[model samples]
Target: MCRWLAYSGTPLLLDTILYRPKHSLIDQSLHARMGVETTNGDGFGIGWYAPESGSDTPAILRDIGPAWNNRNLREIAQHVKSHLLFAHIRASTGTAVQQTNCHPFRHGRWMWMHNGSVKGFHEMRRELSLAVDPGLFLDIEGTTDSEVMFFLAMTLGLEEDPPQAVAKMVGLLERTGREHGIAAPVQMTVAVTDGTTVWAFRYASEGGARSLYYSTKVDSLRAQHPDATYLQELSEDTRLIVSEPLGDLPGAWNEVPEHSYGIVHGGHDSLHEFAPIMP
Candidate 1:
């Protein structure tokens, strides 16, 4: 398991939440209250898109160390700002702790991260990998089941239709697991983006998926609590989707429903029911 967050809407410093919040990702790295393990010290990664540079692709930074004590990460959080970003603190689920295995994996314009594990990954990896498009198969860089899920999505036409591709990928995983007699083959709360748009999902093969939440609209909260200082600092468009809330701000977060996915872009947020793509 791991802890991660995705932000879009306003260009803000990374430290604003990574380090400043009461229950920030850095805090989760040591005292995670919701993950399977309370410690996610294996590694960490960050990915963000900066439109001022005229590039649509996201830039990524990853290291195999604790996020709380990384001097380089602190420096970057203080300097770099983005309208959309991803930050993750990882807890290995049977994979080596290495930079390549750290998340926010990227392929051209797309970036992805996952927080969960495949029940019998070692037993089903070869079969699942063969299902990936031959060209994409070689792109695999790490041994984690997370990376395999990403490439599998690409092979299933991720760029053209993300939801469909992911659904297909999940369906395939379940089928493969059943074939191998492993129930509950997958459990994940994931995020993927292509600079302009973001998609987040929460699901498990046998249900009881990980925790995921999105902050309530800042403008609405500001209207209700007119004198709230934090609300005043935010733009109406700023949004955050995180594994655990950054703080205990009231009416500031809403849990994403089980078996659903959300899309955040511009000022439009949409939630849709999600189900596996049955063959």
Candidate 2:
């Protein structure tokens, strides 16, 4: 189990969201309210797109250490600014605790992070590895099922059709798990981005997925709590999608439906049913 958050909107200092919230991601690293484990101190990572001349590749800073105790993280958070960002705190399921195992795995201009596990991952590892394209296989730098899942999506065309490719990859993963006698083959709440748009999925083979939530209508929130103060501080187009609501503001979050995927970009959002991939 892990906790993660994705931000897409006007560029702002990372600390504003990763540290300033009442219960920020760093706080959740030690006291996650809805994760399977309260503490996710195994490791952490952050990925952000920097303003460049003609490229959109995100610069990522990852470490195999507790986010709460990392002085470098605090320094960078205050200095960096980006329109798209991802931060993750890990609680290793069975993977080794190493820097490479940290989330916000990168490939080309794309970045990804996961907050759940692939059931019976050990048994399905080989089969899953064999499915990745050789090019992607060479790029895999870690041994976590999360990284494997990211490569799988890339194999199935993540850069082109993120939502569909992810659905296909998950479908294959669930099928392979069941083939190995795993009843609930997968449990994942994943988020992937290409520096421009973000795609998040909530699904489980057994139909009981982990928690995933997205912010409520930005316009609606502004109208309802016109003087919430903080609400007025952000750009009208800013949005956050996370493993859990960042705060308890009423009507500030919406639970993503089971077996569904959410796409956020250009000040708009959409959710679609996820169809399992067939063998």
User: What lDDT does the true structure give each of the candidates?
Assistant: 0.92, 0.89
Model 1 agreement with the true structure over 1-279: per-residue lDDT tens digits: 899999997788988868989999999999999899999999999999998898888999999999989999999999999889999999999989999999999998999999999999999989888988998888889999999999999988889999999999999999999999997898999999888889999999886999999989988889778888977888887889999888887898999999999999897798999999954
201 Cα displacement, candidate 1 (Å): 0.5
lDDT of 1 at 73: 97
Q: Work out the TM-score per prediction.
A: 0.98, 0.97
Error of 1 at 69 (Å): 0.2
Tens digits of per-residue lDDT, candidate 2, 14-119, equal 9998999877899999889999999999999999998663677778888989999999999999988888999999999989989999989998899999988888
